[model samples]
Target: MTDVPGFPPHTQLLAALARLGQATRMDAVRNAGPHNLSPLQADIVGLFRRGAAVLRQSDIVTALASTAPTISDAVRVLRRKGLVDATADLADARARLLVLTPAGEAEAERLTAFSDGLVEAVDTLPEQDLAAILRAGTRLMRELESRNLIPMSRMCPTCRFFVPDAHPGEVRSYHCDFVDAPFGAAELRVTCPDHEVRD
Candidate 1:
């Protein structure tokens, strides 16, 4: 697409905003090491960080606009990794309540700091441009969420498109040697080329 100057109208502006937001998120994952979280896990952690008290699997699925299975799988991984703790919901034995562990809390803090730095950097942009970007980004994100096209489970670390430690808070966007194509929620499988199935 040709780059038209001055916020290429609404649709183009939203698409560009989505791309930028994705890029920023990928960058944050590259910088925060030790544990590599999938986008869904990161979102879950972020929600918890933002005071999502008493979350259920369904809640996460709704928030991330992902399929139930995808959210369940991500939650399982997070639980296995000791990043999240789950308990049977008092009212519904079949439903589990999820919460961040102490370790998860620490990691969330780091992630939040990284995100803050990212936003602060963006804040340096001219006021009008920054406002436009924010508006576009928010609109695009909401639209994607509604469409269930936002791959909550996809993460830079596990995707074939990811380049390990490419740079702090930054990873190549789904262009790594592992997966030839970018990953999405539908591609979540145990035999993915980019990542090994955790036992």
Candidate 2:
């Protein structure tokens, strides 16, 4: 609890994120239920809407930290509901790529509205607060990645194009070689479409 003495900031931040994540999931489920979706189904659809243009069943499992059976069940339900369809993976015939159907696109749009309140709340924060959280959150994600506790993110710092300021004589800049632009600590992309993971 916040009242606890000597509580680590990292622990407190993670706890807060956990609580917020649960609350957001609850809101998503309540709003999506009218459209005949369970919480997991809604989330799977969301991943399809935002994470990638096409995803494998295994990709969902990895992103959600979920089991194969769990993802499989949700995918089945989504397919049956005409929200998604599966096609043979051209790269691997044994695998299937999951794609949202037209109905699924509609559902994604509706879900976006359902979660608009959460977005608005975050957007209402002071600019400094927003910048602080984004920096801290990205650092925490990097730490988690180092410990193998989570999947590697597409954060700017991990990209091949990232050039962190090091020398005192330097301009103290964060540059992206790929874009030929300065990337400030607060303006870094959390999930970028063009992200190429560093080795």
Candidate 3:
């Protein structure tokens, strides 16, 4: 095995752990359902699924650190598939809100099940190893989150803080309730408080 600098002899072990986690998530998405969601789609669904009670398209964009057009396309596709729904914002007459449909919720549950299985499998490992893995994974997540590398866009429609446009043709800023502010069109590089980077 090739040696990585600064990492100990267990580097391969670490790599294997990371790869297994990723593979498990991919497998979950693959086995989830007929949704046939792209990685982006899956991410978006995941966002909405987790935030079924309240979500919005702009929330998804901010979380994903993506452009409005990118999120709009994903939202359109999800809507076409009948996985998500958009409604007028009660407080803001100009904004619409996004949420998952029953079918979408079911699909999201399936994906969550897949993820749960992976966690259970990991739990079956030796206690020491499992503990180490947990600690390492937590550390890794913190480091990545600090770098804004986690996939935030996937949760677009599911984010509790998302606020969509009420009128289809009307252009409006994406409001993130979590951040208590709307994203400015020119502030693409600025990270919001709810930002979650997705790979």
Query: Could you tell me which residue pairs clash in candidate 1?
Result: 27-169, 27-170, 30-169, 31-169, 160-179, 161-174, 161-175, 161-176
lDDT of each: 0.63, 0.80, 0.64
In lDDT terms, how accurate is model 1? 0.63
The digit string of per-residue lDDT tens for model 1 on 42-158 reads 877877765455699988877567789988888898888888999889899899998889988887787665556676877688755754554444445446645767643333333
Better model by lDDT: candidate 2 vs candidate 3: 2
What does the lDDT read for residue 151 in candidate 2? 79
The alpha-carbon deviation from the true structure for residue 134 of candidate 1, after best TM-score superposition, in angstroms, is: 3.7
Q: Per-residue lDDT tens digits of candidate 3, residues 1-199?
A: 9766776756977688689868866775566469788777777877765544566667888766788899999889989999888999998887679888998788677665555666678668775565455445545655665688774322323345556442345333556566666643222222233545333
Off by over 4 Å in 3: 1-18, 115-124, 151-199
What tens-digit string does per-residue lDDT give for candidate 2 at 1-77? Answer: 55768768878877889998888878876686556788889878877665687999999998877899999999998
Better of 1 and 3 by lDDT: 3
Query: Which candidate ranks first by TM-score, i.e. highest?
Result: 2
Better model by TM-score, 2 or 3? 2
